[model samples]
Target: MNPIRRRPHIDYELDAGGRRSLWQTLPTLTPGLGVLRHYERRWLRLDGFAGIAVVAYMVPQVMAYTAIVNVPPVVGLWTALAACVVYAIIGGSRVLSVGPESTVALMAGAAIAPLAGGDPERAIVLSSALCLVVAGWCLLARLFRLGIIADLLSQPLLVGYLAGGAVLMVVGQLGRVTGTDVEGETIVAQLRSFFSVVGDTHLPTLAVAAGTLTLLLAIVILRPRWPGPLIAVAAATIAAVVLDLPAYGVAETGPVPVGLPLPHLPIISWADLQTLLLAGLGVAVVAYSDNTLIGRAFKPKTEPGEKSVPDVDPQQELVAMSGVHVAAGLFGGFPMSSSGSRTALAIASGARTQVYSLVAAVCIIAVLFFAGPLLEPLPSAALGAVVIYAASKLVSIPDIKRLARFRTSELVLAIVACLGTVLIGILAGVGIAIALSILEMVQRLARPHEGVLGRVEGIAGMHDVDDYDQATTLPGLVVYRYDAPLFFINVGDLRRRALLAVEKENEGDPDHPVRWFILNAEANVEIDISATDGLKALHDDLSERGIRFGLARVKQDLRTPLERAGLVELIGEDMMFPTLPVMEKAYLTWAAEQAVREQTALEHQAVPGADEPAGTPPARPVDTNESDR
Candidate 1:
């Protein structure tokens, strides 16, 4: 060979035994490089503005959510920053920006207040512990692919639950915004405090709040993506700076540490773990739900206009967001939720990858590292204004309108979940969702749809005693179809109706004793012990009456249970068919054999005058054609 060169890496195949997948380990991608590569793309202008816009909106929200948790505003910034950075690495969603979410923050605050004794440092400690717990839970979830739990939370429940939570969040914040010292230990206590301070509202603060509300509404009705919160926050900061709002009982965003996240792995005692268990569980559910929704929402638009296509891997989202939570805790920060407002901003800004979040993270770091003193002067009122506006977005009118069209029970459940979120707590709201879903499912189970499988006339191998219209039936053979699982709840009705129908068909018909009855098992997924017992009893009773009971189109999964119950043995192999076509063939063969046997018996017994005449025509044939007569 003419100076053979070394084979390129492309030609080198690594041993299959030692290969690791990217997901199994991890991959590094940074926005700076990505942004540089696509500098001339339209995304550069739109997404760049969106990042800054989102950051502006986020600053106040972080402060507000932190406040709700009784932690300092800087902690919010710290947590949000770390979250952004961590998510940039691990998150699959191109636009999702992890940060302090209102619902989760409120939940964290409620959980930590008693344990931390209102100390910011101590609260951070507990939050860190909580974060670890959540991260552990999420990691466990990913390992087990437990993301299906989110699917069980119906849309109606989510809408209602969030609406309820929003109400609670707004009410919870009202006391702090007003000058009144409303007395309460937690949300319920805080609700009382908010109400008590109704008359003590500061006119100026109220005016600011009013103006903010108006701006947000105008934005909702017109430019939905307008930076109303950012503008409102800027205005609040200017007012606090120039108006000396603190002296007039306006709270201020106190000192925020401007440095690294101290790595203090929380050492909570077993006692502490016990106390936080319920709260931890609640946070796990709410955080998973809230984060997944946001993550999936911001997942890159793969199919044009196919917003419903959820491309974000739920397991990935959990891992990413939980990691962010852990990172935030390491850096002396409050608990965070997936930020919807910032996400919307990112989408509006033409962000192509998760780099915008990284940019946001850097910006937060810069603000904390070098621009600290500048932010220190920022007022609590401004942050409060930001919080109010961010929370307002949780209430979606279109969602409510959509909810209105659903079943009353589901709609009521949604409303209950929302109110529960508002008046009770986040956990209760989720519980209601679970309860309602199960209940609705149970309602269907209670009275399942059962139909007589009667084929129309002029149909080949036809049969039916039609419920929808007058139709012919096979003289003595009946087919019943149940469109639900065979279970204890509905088994009694099945036994009663099937037996009665068989008996009625035999009413003194000289030539016909109900010979065969077949149950359509196409939709039945399973039959439990109780159902099996009922079926055994039905088989015995029908056999005693000289009738054969069998099945048609029993799905594969149900075969094992039926076999284990000796149903197949009792029904005989020839009587069970995998498809309707085969079943029809089997039925026709059985009918012909029975007809021959009947004629043979009649001729054999013809010695006496008791023999019936051949004048009586044979029984009507079954027609199984799908079309109606």
Candidate 2:
């Protein structure tokens, strides 16, 4: 395997020998060295343009998401500042923008809300615990190399989930955009206070925010590379300052440290860990989904002529992503994830390597030290617009249309999620969508397609007797094929299916009822007690009726479970076969023996010279209910 670089920045001081100690080097490498590297590069012009643009848009975007978390606006700036430095050394993607995000912050707040007794200390500790869990979980996933879990969310579900979240995000920010802290868990509460508070709206703040949102949207539509958020904030900050907007109750992002951060662990407890477990999982799921998506988009360039990029190693991406957030939590930074919008922006602006992230980091340091003061009067509305617009991208009308084309179940779930977000919270909306997804999956599994196998005239292989139009059943052999695992969820259904197969066999010809039932156990991988008992009951009933039973193609692991339960012993060693061919051969031999027995009975009756009439067949009692049958 080719070794992926741990850091994005190119090494100047380290020789090949020093660089060989790859994992040991840290981003805490030296600030002076970073500045020197930034200025000494031949690619300075290209990087400078990209870096400045990222930093520009990042300012207001940072404040917007920070407010969504209901945290101090400075936390967002601090997060952007710290993450750019940390990921500069360890990040993998060229276009990845690591910073505060609406999803992560909103999730963090939800996880820590229970622990907050109006105490910032408690919130901080709980939040850190949550990040720790994410980091540890991600690293563990990497160790196991479990990337498939990310795709488990699926395209349809993701579209639905994001669409719901985006709508909720826009609605949630309405209060802030209108200059009120009227927070609610739902849409109605947000719109509830507007009647009384419209008169209280801060005109200057609204004006700046509205202008900023409009500008950001326009940039996204027209020249997405211009770093519109950064420009808007700068322009708005100047306007606010000149017009004395703060005097009209307009908020501002005050001073932020422009230098370095000293990392420290977050204070936490076992209780906090328990409380935040669900929220942490939400972060894990969303972060990996976003990371894997972006990593695949990069088309990992190596050979010039390769048409496809190598598949993303999702487990590793999770570990890297979780590590960044953990570091952020440990330091004075809030949580973050791969910024999908920003990553798209960077890629669209012609970023070629992960070096873009490194350059972006250097640019952020410059902002902290030199341009921190310029952010002072950035109005809340502009930040709100930044968030609203960022989130708006997540809602897709085309995707919803596609979902409707494919399946109604998916469309309904997506709609439910979208509506849920506005009615509930972002995290809650995600939870609802997941629950719906899982429910749909379980319904399919629980009602697995089982059928009676019958040979067909045109089809080469045996097909379902009831499902196909031109299938013919064997004379007296009943074949039941189960297509899902046997579990407690469908044990009752299993019993009913087994009994129905027998009833169907007798209904066709009671005199020549199926003498044997062959269970096609190809899909029966595992079995639980309830299903085993259901099978056992059917086995005893069939045996009493003189109907023999046999199993074909039971998986290897299922043998022990059958043996341990004495099911195999009761069914007889000769009855269970490894493959369908073996079972078919055994059935032929059994059919011959049954024919001989019938012939012998007829001969005995004829020889008896009137002991009994050969034309008369043994009678089966007529009964409709269990009491009579």
The Cα error of candidate 1 at residue 266, in Å, is 2.8
lDDT per residue for candidate 1 within 528-559, as digits (tens), equals 98888888888888878777788888888998
RMSD of 1: 8.5
Per-residue lDDT tens digits for candidate 2, residues 218-336, read: 77679766777777667777777898877878776665445555667776667766766667777777777677776677632333773443454455466567667777777656667
Least well predicted 10-residue stretch by lDDT in candidate 1: 620-629
What does candidate 2 score in Cα RMSD to the true structure?
9.2
Count of residue pairs whose backbone atoms collide, per candidate: 16, 7
Q: How much does each candidate deviate from the true structure in C-alpha RMSD?
A: 8.5, 9.2
Report the C-alpha displacement of residue 308, candidate 1, in angstroms. Answer: 14
**Best candidate, TM-score:** 1
Reference-based TM-score, model 1? 0.82
